[model samples]
Target: MGRHRNDPRGIAQMVAIGGVIVLFITLVILGGFFLYKSLPSGSDTAAVPEGAAGTTADPQAEEMPTGSLYIRAVGESSEVVVTVPGGDVLADTTLKTDEYLSFTEERTLSVTIGRPSEVEIYVHGERQDVEGEDPGYSFAVQP
Candidate 1:
């Protein structure tokens, strides 16, 4: 009763080591699901203010708004919210570390955002008067 010698090359090397451990766990779960969907998924929600300035009391002596809202920062922090509608002004602007914030306007704007930041609201004074449209402010950012 000694019939034990059926090694088909050790079951084809244990099925090629279980198909290389299931192709390395399916490429590490599709590379962690595309690195969690390329990160930066904070879902951006507020940022809109670029030109048309007149919150009174001097911001370079007001009166210059044909569109200009520029905030720059590659990394470290950013929060912006600028809303201006016939006077109930709002400004929560912040761009830290590599800092930069600018505005000039003629009234008419809207912005909502979050995370993965890099903004440049255009139409800036190419000799002014692109025919009015700027004045909207409320910004936010810290650290």
Candidate 2:
């Protein structure tokens, strides 16, 4: 039958084709694995707790902002004289601890001067002062 028609050549061609197919399959599998790893991890979700979804917790989730202020007299029992803008005393009673004397509609704050020294007033964590006028030794707080 014409010397078996070069059977070795056909076997070699089949082996080459099989090698190429195996290489293509390996490349596809590797590409899929890399894509899965590049996707967002469980820590990226906002509603889920960190470290419980087989991933570390989000660093931002642990931080929170608590908006509040605490004011205290700079000295031991100084005369905290408080006033409104128009030379109006905040209240008839002297401002002390556990008292709410310096508030205006929950926005504007009345400042308290403890004595006749230069006093510094603050509102919302910012300085509120009069130009060229001494605030006296009273302390003020923002509401």
Candidate 3:
């Protein structure tokens, strides 16, 4: 007698094939996730703007002058000076290698770095190329 489509052996074989397919799909998805995580994500510090030293305004963060300035000492020990027009100094101190500082300032602000190449600056969530041709670098931001 010929076996029917719903026979016990046929049902078992179909279930096994379905399980194998599911396992294969799961493995493929897991492999893709690992590959994505393994790739280099790059550093946020590398987002500095190209060409001349200046502040690149971020349109998305242009609501007000209330924003934070991030300073990281990359090279040797250096001093970071922040001044606001008609206001007290925001920050004035020496930053050593791997050391960092941040301050929230409003309105017009000025920043001076003793060692241009030794420091990295970010304003209002945007990277500012404070490194200039000279040893020291300074720039003013109005917003």
Candidate 4:
């Protein structure tokens, strides 16, 4: 009969190496998936339109997160104040040229804008009218 070459240590070593290889492959795949997602898909975004318009509900109801609001300052910069319906200020900051502020609250939000004429407002992906305020003024948006 031929000598048998069955070593327990060798079998365990092979299994450990196989596990390491699988881990490495999984890490590589996840890295590539995240990189692809991070890249910008397009530069042609929809424009909000001119003039001070009011906040609009999502017509398609698919562009933004449900029960949340996304407010963006387009074309120019503006000072904004974000508050809940109870008048508690959540944020008061100045938006630079083309900036955005997001609110997670579902209640109505009051946004006071400075330099309203130069700044354009966009809610979610659709354009919003600043309510036709030429100077510093305020408007409301409910999500």
Best by TM-score: 3
Which candidate should be chosen as best, given lDDT against the real structure?
Answer: 3
Task: Give the per-residue Cα lDDT of candidate 3 at 14.
Answer: 95
Candidate 3 matches the true fold with a TM-score of 0.48
Q: Looking at model 4, which ten-residue stretch has the lowest summed lDDT? A: 50-59
Residue-by-residue lDDT tens digits, candidate 2, 54-120: 2121324322211222223222223444444556543333323222222322333344454322323
In candidate 4, which residue pairs get closer than 3 Å at backbone N, Cα or C atoms, i.e. clash?
52-129, 52-130, 53-129, 53-130, 54-129
CA lDDT of each prediction against the hidden true structure:
0.46, 0.41, 0.66, 0.61
TM-scores for candidates 1 onward, in order: 0.29, 0.30, 0.48, 0.45
Instruction: Put down candidate 1 lDDT per residue, 105-124, tens digits, no spaces.
Output: 55554333233334333335
Compose the digit string of candidate 4's lDDT tens values, residues 36-108: 9988665433223232233232323344432345555555566777777776776666665445555555678
For residue 64, model 3's alpha carbon misses the true position, in angstroms, by 20
Q: What is the lDDT of residue 12 in candidate 2?
A: 88
How does candidate 1 score on lDDT? 0.46
Model 3 per-residue lDDT tens digits across residues 1-143:
99999899999999999999999999999999999998867532222223312323232332333246767777877777777788557666666665565555456778788887787777776877766636657788667
**Predictions: Cα RMSD each:** 13.0, 21.2, 11.5, 9.4
At residue 2, give the lDDT of candidate 3: 95
Name the regions of candidate 2 deviating beyond 4 angstroms.
1-6, 45-143
